[model samples]
Target: DQQVKQNSPSLSVQEGRISILNCDYTNSMFDYFLWYKKYPAEGPTFLISISSIKDKNEDGRFTVFLNKSAKHLSLHIVPSQPGDSAVYFCAASLRGGADGLTFGKGTHLIIQP
Candidate 1:
């Protein structure tokens, strides 16, 4: 069974607007959440991460929020740009990320002009 899931396969947002990508998990053992961005022909790169203990984490234009009770998390990209158009993967790991991460199917975010 897929422990991590991204229900929306794609999301479109206007350029300079906020882009929100969502993820949900079935595994309660997960304690860390990480977001990764991937462009064509390139490996996924880490964008931001949040711990289960915290509800929110922000870095630059990106922010991540976790709802432990809901087993859900989201990534927000403010003033999204063309460069922000990519596939975003939501990953989870147990116990401060000591073990390997379990990744979602990925959501393709499209920044439109």
Candidate 2:
């Protein structure tokens, strides 16, 4: 079974609106969570991350929130632009891991004009 999950397969938002993406996890041992954006025919690039100890982490127009109790997390994008359109993946990992990251299938975010 997949430890990380992105329930919504896709989302659409206006060019200047806010876009919200959600993710859920079944593993309690995960201590770190990250969000990545991937363009077609390219590898994923890191967006933002949050540790289990913190409830929120923000950078620029992006924000990530974690809820350890519910084993859920979310990513928010403000003033979403068409350039932000991409496949967003949620990944979870332990503090130190040789197994690498467990990633969700991803959600395709489209910015409509």
- Scored by TM-score, the top model is 1
Compute the lDDT of residue 42 as modeled in candidate 1: 99
Q: Worst 10-residue stretch by lDDT in candidate 2?
A: 91-100
What residue pairs are clashing in model 2? none
**What tens digits encode model 2's per-residue C-alpha lDDT throughout 2-109?**
899999999999999999999999999999899999999999999998888899999999999998999999999998999999999999999733358999999999
lDDT of each: 0.96, 0.95
The TM-scores of all predictions, comma-separated, are: 0.98, 0.96
RMSD to the hidden true structure, all candidates: 0.6, 1.2
